[model samples]
Target: MATTPPVIQAKITSDPVKLPLAPLLVSVVVGVVVATAGVGGMICYLLRSGKVPIRVAGVAPVVPTAPLKTHMVALEPLLVNLADPSGSAFLRAGITLSIEDPAEDKGKETNAGEAKPSSKDADAALRDTALTVLGQQTSDQLLAANGKERLKAELKSALAEHNPTVKVADLFFTEFLVQR
Candidate 1:
């Protein structure tokens, strides 16, 4: 007896399933916009609440006020004998002083008979004070590494004591010589 092939059946559809592109794209764009807005809002909130610190680049901090104006007064050079043994050492120094202008200090009150000190008198006093301080230094002391700085401090202190009216802001040694 001859047997025929078993019968097989299958179903097929001719129509393809379709997806709408416009709605899909719109949904994706909306999602992205919402996410960006949320992140931006969070950052703004943090900054406003002081929870995050921000530093700007290439910007200097603001200064509160302008600095006081000062004038420089150059004194005549001084030559003095050093306080060294054998009387063999001497010093020659040129000094300049940075003094705050009295005109800028309007807060000070002067007496009726007390005339403001003249610049000439102040200059004379400064020269005298400087000579006195310079004559006390020895060649060895002035030749050290920090000698000039020490001398400046001494001169400043002496100037303040000798003349309270003159506000010495700083001192500069234009010329210095220590001969042994």
Candidate 2:
């Protein structure tokens, strides 16, 4: 006798399962509102805490700067004959002096107001010192690549001999002409 095969059972539904649209939309809207509120709160906190730099109308920010050490002053041009063996070379140079700020000086003051000479007095004193220094330089010395720097250092040293309070910062030759 042949055995009959076991019958298979099957269940079928006509309607499809669907997710509720209202709940999904409500959740999305709640998430967006929460995110927006969080961003707005952060912005408000930053503004209130003064962490953000805000420039107001006609208001400038106070920035810290290093104290100025040196200042520049223009000096009258000097015409001097160079100390050459042939004595034919001469130099005409317009020198600008970079002087140290006396206000920033920490040295002890002895004479105070009376001892501190005016810039005009200092310049007048510097004129003779400059002429002496230039007159001592040879044509080759003034014409070299490092001539100007050497001259500046020499002049600073010479000027210091005359006036210790008048510190020389630098020297610039605006017009340099050598005549032989």
Tell me the TM-score of each prediction against the true structure. Answer: 0.60, 0.53
Per-residue CA lDDT of model 1 for 74-133, tens digit only, reads 888899999999698999899989887677455565565653444788899999999999
Give the TM-score comparing model 2 with the true structure, all chains together. Answer: 0.53
Off by over 4 Å in 2: 1-65, 104-118
TM-score of 1: 0.60
**Ten consecutive residues with minimal summed lDDT in candidate 1?**
109-118
Reference-based lDDT, each prediction: 0.89, 0.83
lDDT of 2 by residue, 1-180 (tens): 999999988878789899999999999999999999999999999988999867779878899986555666777899999999999999998988777766745343344334333467777888888998999999998889999888888988898898797778777889899998
> Distance from true position, residue 52, model 2, in Å?
30
Over 4 Å off, model 1: 1-63, 103-118
Q: Which candidate has the top score in lDDT?
A: 1
